[model samples]
Target: MQAIHKRLQALTLLIAEDDESTLKWLSRVLSIYFKEVRVAKDAMQALELFKESPSDVIISDIEMPQVDGLHLLQKISQLSPNTIRVVMTAYNTPEYINIAVESNVDFYLKKPIDIDEFLVAISSSVSKGSILSEEIFLNEDYSYSYKQKLVKKGQESIKLTKKEVLLLELLLKNRKSIVSIEQIEHSVWQESVSADAIRMVVAGIRKKLYQGVIENVKGLGYRIE
Candidate 1:
């Protein structure tokens, strides 16, 4: 656990679980290595903490009151989806597992935690960084390295959800031009999405960008210029 702790301590982790005992154990384990470990007893609290500041990795329980893991994952995907996520569950339900996969979770572990194995899994996931090629750049404003799967803005690096990165890449590829809504949908999700879907994604991006980072061309697609 010493080596694992060293690697983990280099990161900022967020743990979302309602169980006090489980949270305590996790806190102890992570505290041994992680410099900072943020805890949220419920999904709402997790969301609040996430909005306040994102983490390098997130470990959440699948079952919890207020907001379940699945819903929290969805929100994370919208906000800071690039962070590595691990979902823990006590029951092995096919339906829940399917949802976890769909949510793009890095790992799903059954309860009755094995300290050594869990540490190994965390080490593996942390090394992977953001899941996807970091080589793709999102224009002059943001640069992405597929190898690191990292997104950077000028001197500062910003964390982007996978979906957000995809959208930004598409827009950058079509800079100074109005990318059609359908085109964006096809390129990003490989399927057509409603205006609301696009709008929601745009809103998420805007919130992060926070200062007219993306421009909306009325009745047309969005652009970075």
Candidate 2:
């Protein structure tokens, strides 16, 4: 555990789990390394805390009351795409694996929590954190780095979901014409989605960037001007 990078201690981490004993154990171990460790007994509380003050990383359990960890991770992905997401689970089923991939999980800490395994998982996340990359200027206000997989407005990062990133990338790729709704679904969602759902995602990107950053074609689709 001491082998873990010192840079990790500079980050804030949040852990969501319903079990009291497990919560305490994780809190005790991680609190030593992280600058701050905030624990939530349920995914809802975790969501609330994240919205209030987004953490650098989050580790959530698969089984919990009302909401599961995968769903929570999805929300986190929407709220802060750059935040490293990890799942804690006992089951290694294909179903869980698929969902975790869709939610953009970075690592998995299996149940029974070996001290070595958990430390390695955190270290992996820290390794994922730092990288030097060139930026592609998207607009006057925002720039994106493909290597870092991030969008930035000057110094502040624009919080966006993975779907939002895909949609933005699609529009930027087709900056000349309106990318039809069908195209958005195929490239971004990869499945059929309602117009309203698409609208919400577009609206979300605009909110993060600027209103005029994304232009709606009214009847067709959208594009970046």
Candidate 3:
């Protein structure tokens, strides 16, 4: 067994819970272990936070005001497929079970959550994920490593800013289609930014990593292909 508990200290967690008490209690406790624990009082806020900066692992309550956890998890899944998703619900009926399975949820926990069980769920998830390395090659010259979060060209290694990396990843992930300005702002920039600001980032990446690779779609968005 790996030292999964030790890995918690380096990972970031996002918890979406409606109940005020549960949210507060969860934030207070989980903060002790995980390097960063972000709490959202509702699923909408959770979605926004997730868009701003996706968490390594997400824990969401099933029931919410406007949107439920299942829906949120579905959106999160589309946004970041690598993210580990867990749902908590008081009602563990066949309906929810089937929906959870359909949503590709890694684990389902009942309400009145046990901290130990939560930890075990997280540990089990880590154990199941690929231990092998992952690399994304941008071109014959440049390649990126998911583990190192860095791109390399020839013998020199280049590091990217958080926004730069997010922008690069977003564009590369959706290489088939245009990444709309709205999507880029939501995923790459934490807050709203002007088109010029976005262009600057793109220009920087082009100058540094892959020149003339990223394409612009007028009045639409950016794309790699």
Candidate topping TM-score:
3
Instruction: Score residue 208 of candidate 3 by CA lDDT.
Output: 77
Q: Rank by lDDT, descending?
A: 3, 2, 1
For lDDT, the strongest prediction is 3
TM-score of each: 0.58, 0.57, 0.73
Regions more than 4 Å wrong, model 1: 131-225
Question: Candidate 3: where are CA atoms >4 Å away?
Answer: 127-150, 153-155, 159-162, 169-180, 191-200, 211-225
lDDT of 2 by residue, 15-131 (tens): 999999999999998888887999999999998777655677899999999999999999877555557788989998888888888878887767876766766776775566421
Please give, for residues 44-130, the per-residue lDDT of candidate 3 as tens digits: 999989888778789999999999999999998777666789999999899999999999888899989888888877876656651
lDDT of 2 at 94: 87
Rank candidates, TM-score, best first: 3, 1, 2
**What's the true lDDT of residue 126 in model 1?**
58
Candidate 3, after superposition: displacement of residue 10 in Å?
A: 2.8
State each model's CA lDDT, in order. 0.73, 0.78, 0.82
Q: Summing lDDT over every window of 10 consecutive residues in candidate 3, give the lowest-scoring window.
A: 126-135
Report the Cα lDDT for candidate 1: 0.73
Candidate 2 at residue 90, lDDT? 92
* Of 1 and 2, the candidate ranking higher by TM-score: 1
